[model samples]
Target chain A: MQQRDNENRLSQEYTNSVLLNGTLQTPKWWPYLVSILGFFVVIGFVLFGIQIKYGLGVTGLNRPIYWGLYITTFVFWVGISHAGIMISAILRLTQAEWRRPVTRAAEILTIFSLATALVFPLIHAGRTWRIVYWLIPYDASRGIWPNIRSPLFMDPIAISTYLTGSTLFLFVALLPDLAVLRDRTTGFRKGFYTILALGWRGNPRQWKMQVVGGILLSALMLPIFVSVHSIVSWDFAVTTAVEGWHSTIFAPYFVIGAVHSGVSAVVTMMALMRWGWGWNEFIRPEHFDALARLLTVVATAWLGFTFLELLFALYGLDAPEIALREMQIFQYPWNMLFLTFLLTGYILPVPMWIFKRIRTNIALMFWSSILVNIGMWLERFLIIVPGLARRTPFVFTWEAYSPSWFEWYILFWSFCWVTLLMLIFSRVFPLVPLFEQKESEVFSDDIKIGRATVPTIFREEEE
Target chain B: MVAEKNRSWGMVIDTDKCNGCSGCVTACQVENNIPLNDQNKFERGRVMSWIRIERYWEGEFPNVKARFIPIMCQHCENAPCEPVCPVYATYHNNEGLNVQVYNRCVGTRYCANGCPYIVRMFNYWEPTWPEEIRNHLNPDVTIRSRGIMEKCSMCMQRIKRGERNAGDQLQDGEIKTACQEACTTGAITFGDLNDPESEVSILAKSDRKYSLMPQLNTNPNVVYLATVDPYKDKNLGEKAKTNEH
Candidate 1:
């Protein structure tokens, strides 16, 4: 009884400290970082405005490379969004306790990254004003139905569904935490959390419903997350003329690839939060150890899928396919980037991640995650550009495309946009779920081993 | 109705007669109001040529050979560019022309990528016409706006004008495309394939006729007559005689 009382006190103290972070004064660098990112975000918008006013010629998109860095960035961010549900939903559903501290930060990652991605279709459109024609369901004015067959139509539908579903999931899980803040704080802060809390008094039924609702939402969103990236891949896959794009394997290849990058991004984000916010105790190295093991398996699968695509290309021996492969190897101006993608994405990470020491090192996890995402960005570029370079059999029209300043600026600025929104969001919301964190510590007990006590998770098991 | 179903507008290019000339390219620019490509645009691969003449150099130094082929929109029956269009901006029309709806295009450029012919061109900038050149712009065809995808229409404006002028029925040789009109060597032939009596139908059936990248199964309307080589013929003749013997 005395030890149990001590355990309850320990859990209570940990909960209070975590909860107090939400009420802490805004950090010094917060506004400064926001301002700088906000400035660049403005610049991105201005550049897009210029492109819209002057036409796509302002960017270096020529005849064949109709989709350029804009599309690559779009796919990258959408792929980043998959990280949230994969880490939060799948792990939570499996009852993994490591997800507790990371859940809120990861789910918001989905919201902001997806928000950033949604801007690209508008930015890259040839006629920005006429994009509305695609949104209008009825075809009466346009004289033809928006082609239901096109993967372009599926993107908006699937993305919006996932976004709305995930947002509701985030808010519903957030209520009990908000209720805690409401009871403890005063002034405008009290009123704000109170209304958002929706009058929850930590009632048993409300908690029960919140838990069940979260699981149901997670169940609903899993397929949505998978299909979203698959449909994004189809935008390239259905176009038979672009040699490397029309692939039978693209759908699964894209989904698994997305999962790899998304999980790696979560690891990178957790490492950043550990250092930047000094949340070391909460986001421990042990969390990254588990994540790195997952990353190694995912990277191995990705490597297999990538090489399978290459083998299929070689098998066809089709002229366009051969030409595209040759260009990727020898002719791409950014050949060094491809080499780096192969090294960091598959070659280096695979071997390094196999060792538990490298996986457990926080600094290595940080650097490796960043390298993996960079490799992923290049992978998206390799998938898009080379296919268009050797687009047709006509030798005269076969031309190379290099992204101009506008593309680079927009891509960099989009990163800023995502970072800025996440920073601003961090200031207002609870980064870690107070309720779940306390519950995890309360449920777990140390079991007596031969020489040491190991944590034995005492909870419901799969029947 | 069956007769209408059999009607396929097609083109035949006799590569044997085509000299390495830029007249057809020039005439296409003038007639279609395609913007004059500056050096910067050409360097950037933004050239707006609707129909272009491609020159291929076959051999080194002494036996140097340059082959000129006039390439344009093939208007394929199963066009790779068609179904991929989200807005249906480009599709095969009833008359066999692969029509591009300039106004309808949101400029995703999927059609440009899906085109194996590399024939589809995008307007990078709103095409600027010098004041004097503006006055001479063809009134029959729309000057495509910037941010729209455009390509050779097979002179659809002329096809319509000729059909309208011909009243109830169309006549053979009554209509011709700008490229055909500008080809001084009589290399380009355009006609209705449904009319088996037409010149294009006869040439399309020729032993040497072939479509570009026929293995892709695009069923392109533009058929090419392989260029006849005198030096290669002697080698082929000796091989054929040996096989017979």
Candidate 2:
């Protein structure tokens, strides 16, 4: 009996080690790779500092193309951020069993990406300090409130609300996981985990409340996510100057683009985690295949929207619209870039995902995911700059803008910053929810079938 | 209340007389303290111009006929820009003027989009004034910064000043916008449109007078007297009537 009890304790210890020691077992080569990438991040920061000091003048933005890399990156980062809340909230709502291991990473990505994306708009502002005026209900001596008619005023409200809601949701869902970590860990980790756990015991009442709150927050966040991007689209669509920009199609186009880029980012991150942490056993091939199928659907939706936008433009044939479309397709130097985005962002990814071999092939999926992200960024650029560049009447007024090296460097560094944060997070937190996994394992068919067949018989060896 | 009853501002632009030299564009810029169009800023399509002359080519390259239209705020009776503003930064004054309160503009640019005429321009970057040029800056108009929207106010500061001067002299309907005062060919007329005998009112009633995009139903206060190609009308009799109305 004692030997049997020892065997059971040993099995529990083995499971605990897999859960807790995952980060410690990370290969020595990984840190070296991160440090190398960290060097570029430092370089990006230095360049970004130059931009802040020298003003927007450092970039290549000019008269007709007032908005350039900064605004594009702002939109790109925000779009990428949509993945986290989408994966976590959607999976949690649908009760997807596979979400237990992946949701935390996606949630962290959402929170961090949002935090990073908010900075670009502030950086793009002429007087960054005056941004406070955009906040709601701020009573100034000037007796001016934010222009409610302006989407700029609405942006902060939407983004802040989204940030608050998503962060709260992230923490709420993480509570149970934190409690498990607190009990399992020792030293500084234990103390930190204990505080974060908020003294959550495995009480049924506490679990019920957390679950209920998480559901409510998730439901609230889904619409907020959709609304945030819609508001962003309205920033351009609500304008009268550019013909293509004025279309009603912008709201849905922006949302779909957000989801396309977001899902791609989540897939890319998943691939990296699977490779980096040797999470092959946990993140099975089935997960990748499932994600690829979803990606194909998103790709198709994006493609349809693209064609719809073109069809509407053609049907209207307004002079400005024609000119803008021509500039985007034929006249602009970046026409090739746009064509590539269409081919790769939508076309290439579809076939690869639909084909069984390509979906299962990790390398192909990784490349496709990266391509999708790049294509989405280019898609945003194509939408914004070309239309602004081809404003009505004076064809000679059409001017081209090229981003300066400083802009490029800051963009590179921002990616590094996101990577560095994600790396650190993986180290500190249990990337997989241990208790949830245990609960799932306990409910598996083998244990259930074995229990149903036996009646009150104590089978010690069966352990 | 007494001032409101007698005050109605309007402009009549004679398209035939306009040489399209863009003098009015520069004049309005200088009068309103608009920033210089820096090359870099211009390339990015971020240049700020309160009044821009739009030149439209109506024919093919060899037989091209260019139509020059000077566009600014139309100050429409049913101005589309007014209602969409969440902050009420833009509103129509009692004198039929579409007023843009600079301090109240938070730069969301919804009003700019709502405007079919596309007259509004956003200050994407801070207004730059060279040290020497700072002395030439118009003190009457406030300089705009990035993240704020601005457009031609029909030279609102000039109108206000002109009104005050007329008030001091107690002259009836003497105030005129800067563009009206600067036109060398006497092509632009400014006055109270409500008074039937006013210069703008008489010109607005002419058969040649029309508003751009009249089908849009904006009810624009700015009236354009259509350009007549004299050569095309040469085949008509010597006593051919030039004025349609």
Candidate 3:
């Protein structure tokens, strides 16, 4: 009877370890789904090879419409990447209670989106090999450095700074989580976690240091992300071309758009993780409701900007401005796409979020997120092409641009690449940061409130 | 004394004489060895021309009158594009020309953005020239590839060659840009602005001449004489008579 009791106790301890650690018992379907995603990732690589060999001619870009799908994707992906900083830094600063389980997923979006966004400027360059020239400062040998006055010079600086800051912030926050994985795993996984954990032994001083470093990096990244998109908007706003291109409101307009798309992306990502990881208990309806509320606010701001831009254009009565507005509303072939973006992307999402059923429905949220991305891309296209096509004092020459097959393949591949990265990362790291979740449960308001109400906070501990 | 003779080159276009023929446009392309305007690109609204004519409509519907304005780099005295470049690929020459050095450009596109006229065009893709067409290429001018910015140079090579010839013969006012030579009505004139007696200088001083966006204070080297309608008085009188009838 004593031997049997000892055996039972050992088995119970093993089961409890597996449940708490979240590593020893990953879902059976996880590897299979990852492999399927990897297949598309390889396809994207093959397409990228073709783009490098042929040139930008592989895409649908031409004179007057010099930018197309590549630039649109660049802005959209970059905008989507903003979610990580918003979720992690902004919410933490505000002291939102729900951010504990959500921050890791948000940070992953930032990493993957940035990785995807970097490919565009290279693909858009006529001579990809000469891209290094943009990096080198103007010297006697080079004759001149990049003009200090040009937004083109500012683009690379802003993007690189944001990328560096965000990557650092992501890695720093992952350290404690890595330590947990190290203690729980063995073999090659153990080795991977060991190096990544930086030998963190979870000492009191180490935890304090990790938290401080992570907060500092997050603080730095918040403004860096805002400045990144503002500078990009200036790339167009600084130009003296079509009326819409020269607007002063572009910086804030772009930031709101970025947030609109970014929050939607976060919603989609969270939904996918909840379903895949069976994280129903932790992610719950309350989290979805909170994200929905945020989305509604972003959508409202986007609508205000849209109306404000229109009002200014109409009030100014500038000829080029009038022409561009006409083209966007009634004349251009893609006007329908623009309308869809405004209605479905902005208008529809707002009302839907008010409905509790619609907000919590996983499938509805996913579809809405997808529409928001499409809408954002349309917004980028509308901003870049129409203004350039209708510059004043010339016979309006309307140029029709159609992206080539190579361009389509590249875009498709980029989507595959980002998705694959997210999947691989999900398996390698804990999708939900276990340490953070455990802490939240321990120090939750329910426990604190119970202690305050009873005036016996140490009673449970003594018991 | 030499500097005083030809310190600044400029052009003065008589809009009254311009028939909107686009002769100057094609002529500049041929002389400068500019790339062909691909149809696919044109449809996409990307047409690369060093110089272009802009038409503005003054009124709505039947009363509408189209005003044609030919515009290029104003080659401003206080050039907005000059100060913005982190790299000094573009700068003002001693002769008051806005010079863009192709080989030196890293294609940051900041200069293009900085220029209010939007004259700068970026090489977004590799320029393709067929084997036979390559023979027509001028050896004096370097071909620009992708990742470089380009703009109007006021036919600098032609000006230089003409100056060299004039120096050899001890002559003056002997060189002209392709546009000036191609103009049947003599609407376009190019010469050293420093020479008070030069045709361009005299025309630039005309009462009808004005510069576009003068309020911006760019001090553009390019000047234009406003188009005069010969039938303006007749049309007004006829309208008055019709009203009386």
Candidate 4:
């Protein structure tokens, strides 16, 4: 009975520390960052407006190289969305106690990153206003239904399903925490939390149902996250007339790439949250270590897939593929750029992650994670542009593609948009999942093993 | 049958006779109201011609072999551009021409990127015609606005005009694309491939007649005759003698 009381006190202390941290006053830089983000967002909006007024000609997109930075960045952001929900769901399923503090940031990142990613396709569209034409069911009178066979059509269906699933999963997890905030807060905050809490008073039934709903949503979302990226890859892969894009292995290749970049994004976000908010006690080096290990595996797998794809294309010597592979190796700018992608995405990071010290080092892990994303972005660029440039087997007609400054600006603001949205999201909600974090405490016990005290997790069910 | 009325339009380009005058390119641009391609357009990889002529150099300068080949939309029986269009902006028509529905295009440009031929062009700029040029514009064709892809329709508008003028059916040699009409050396022949008597159908049977990128089996309607070489026999004779020795 005394042991139970002491445990309760420990849980209370943990809860108070996390909850009180959530209601921290907005930092001074918050407004400055938002304003800066606003300035750039307005600039993007202005550029888009001029683009609409003048046509896509305002951008450097032209013949033979029609899809450029817009499509590449679009794919990158969408791939990043895969990181959050997949990590949260898999870790939750495995009953990883360390996953508790990380889940909200990851899930919220997935939702907003997806929201940001969807905007690119619309922006990339030639007839932006008529984008709705694709969504409306094909009418027989018009002799068209949105081409069900097209991967572009599949994008909307997959992303929306994913967006909906992740949003619900996030809300379900937020409810109990919202109720806690409801009890502690007052005035406008109290009412806001009360309504969002959906009349929860920490009753046994509410917890039971919330747990059941979270499990169901997590189960539903894992496959969806997988399929969302696969569908995005098919948008390129099934454009099989292009050489680098014509591989059969693209779906799995892309799914792995998405997780790789996504985990990097998660690690970067976690590092930012940990130090920036002084929540180091809650989000420890162990989480970064775990993420780094996952990243190493993902990066190795990415390298393996890239090697297999290169070998298969080389073996077949299909004319378009042959020409592109030659360019990938021997061509001046692409050769150097491709090497950069290899170094950043795999070669450099893999060796660093093998050492426990480097993996646990927050700064090194953070930068490497950022580097992986940059390399992944380059990977997307190499996939779309070079393949499109050497589009045909006829050597004389082959063209080279490079993005214009116009495209670079849109891409620049897209990152800002993601960061800006994340910043705003911080103000409204706590970065850590208070309910899950507290519940996670119930499982840990420091058991003496050999010569040392080792922290261990206890599970009621093996699953 | 409805298919019978749908003529399978085909073209025969005799590369042997091509003088590389670029007449066909100019004619197509003029006839279709293509925007004036500036130096910047070429630098930016934005050349907008529906049919472009490619030049190949076979040897070093002193003993060089130069070959000129014109490429346009293949109008394949199994068109890669058709199924990839989410809005059905581009599709194979009853007349066996791959048509672009300009109004329907939302500018995804997947069709342009999907095409192995790289023949499709997008409207990066809203087309503007000078007053005098606007007067000469082909009234039968729609001036495509920004964000939509446009490409060779195999002179579908001219074919429609020819059929409409000819009362019922177009005579074998009556219809001509702008490119065919402008080729001074008679290098281009446009006709119905379904009609065995048509020149394209006859030329298609020749051993020398081959489509661009035939390995893809896109089954292009446009066929090309190999550019003949005067030194062919001498080169072969030397190679054969070497093998015998």
TM-score of each: 0.94, 0.85, 0.85, 0.94
DockQ per model, Cα: 0.73, 0.33, 0.38, 0.70
Worst 10 residues of 2 chain B by lDDT: B236-245
lDDT of 3 at A284: 67
Ranking of all candidate structures by their lDDT, best first:
1, 4, 2, 3
lDDT for predicted candidate 1 compared with the true structure: 0.83
Candidate 3 Cα misplacement greater than 4 A, ranges: A1-53, A136-143, A445-463, B1-6, B19-23, B37-48, B52-73, B76-91, B106-133, B162-172, B194-197, B213-219, B236-245
lDDT comparing candidate 4 with the true structure: 0.82
The sequence of per-residue lDDT tens digits that candidate 3 reaches over residues B1-245 is 44544468899988778777788888877777678788865664556678877765554466556666666677888787776554567898888899888876655455664566767777665677678878988776777776677888889998778777777453435777888888878888888787788888898888788886664578899988877754456533332232221
CAPRI verdict (incorrect, acceptable, medium, high) for model 2? acceptable
Model 4 scores a TM of: 0.94
**What local distance difference test score does each model get?**
0.83, 0.74, 0.73, 0.82
Which candidate tops lDDT?
Answer: 1
Q: Which scores better on TM-score, 1 or 3?
A: 1
- Per-residue CA lDDT of candidate 3, range A336-430, in tens? 86788787677767788898898888888878877888788788878776765554443444456677787777778778788878877766777
Once fitted onto the true fold, the runs of candidate 1 whose alpha carbons sit more than 4 angstroms away are: A1-5, A19-24, A185-191, A331-334, A460-463, B1-6, B235-245
Candidate 4 lDDT over B93-163, as tens digits, reads 77778888888899999998789888998888887767888788877777888788899988888988887
